[model samples]
Target: MKKDVRGMLKDFTDGLAAISETNKANVNAFMRLLNTGYKEGALSTKTKELMSVAIGVYNRCEYCIVYHVYKSLEAGATREEIMEAAMVAVGFGGGPSMAYSATLLKDSIDEFENDFK
Candidate 1:
């Protein structure tokens, strides 16, 4: 079935909040760490998002791909930059990365771009 990536993400996040309510402190801490790591530092946020897109492709995580692609766009990463990052993942992860780079990464980019429009 074709998934609405943005809707799926919203549902997942809402469910995650419900499940993590009992451990809110831990969840909040983890979120803080993620925020800190993704913030501009030595690397710009766009660079970090590109790196994340590569990692997401290497790992073949659909959720990761969707999330990071959306973030990469938000951080001003061009489609060319995202594709280059996916190619780097292919270098490291071989055939599997190639498959994801061609399919998942491309789909995520299209999905997110459509969502934003």
Candidate 2:
């Protein structure tokens, strides 16, 4: 969730709940660019998905970790790959962050596995 993003979630969720066409339009534009960069081309969207999970783990973003784990599957990432990515994040992100992120990521782990079946 990044450091300051927690404070912004309310407004963001509120805006989302309101179904503001303007916000949707603007976010769609951003999504196009991001999806192109991360999901298209030969960049291997799985890699980006893993990276997102790693960042979510590192930043301790509960919702982000959950969503990214799901998105990882939606992006064609495997459970082993996602687990390995989280392992790497644990190494680089350290004990507390690693532990916290693992707990958060755990919920999505099962869902991701089932998604493949």
Candidate 3:
């Protein structure tokens, strides 16, 4: 994996974050809402992990993709569930991003394959 994602993203991600922080409170509010939802059981941890994987893939966030795959596995999601999340992601992001997300999750996916049964 590449050590630096700041380049591929061209600081675009950071710029978006910066813009969000300056423009309004939406980003933090959304994060707080999600946190509350997760803590209140309105959103299950597994579902959140799957959603994270989807977002990571769609956004072409390689590190996030890999981390979330492991997170889903740790949260007790099945292999099929993880793959389905990936499918849903690629459905939005197209082939290149899908391929990248899969590559990002490869080792962890292999490590957790048996847990999916």
lDDT of each: 0.85, 0.71, 0.70
Maximum-TM-score candidate? 1
lDDT of 3 by residue, 85-116 (tens): 88888888899766765676555577555655
Total backbone collisions for each predicted model: 0, 0, 0
- Residue 40's C-alpha lDDT in candidate 1? 92
Give the Å error, residue 11, model 1.
3.5
Candidate 3: RMSD over Cα atoms?
A: 6.3
lDDT of 1 at 43: 99
- Sort order, TM-score high to low: 1, 2, 3
* Per-candidate TM-score against the hidden true structure: 0.87, 0.71, 0.61
Q: Cα lDDT of model 3 overall?
A: 0.70
Per-residue lDDT over 1-117 for candidate 2, one digit per residue giving the tens place of the 0 to 100 score: 222333333545566556656577877776678667786556678788888888888777766677677778887788888878888778878996677655657656764567656
Which window of ten consecutive residues has the lowest lDDT sum in model 3?
1-10
lDDT of 3 at 104: 61
Give per-residue CA lDDT, model 1, range 1-117, as digits (tens).
Answer: 456777756776787698687988888888898899999999999999999999989998878887899999988887889999999999999999998878778877877765444
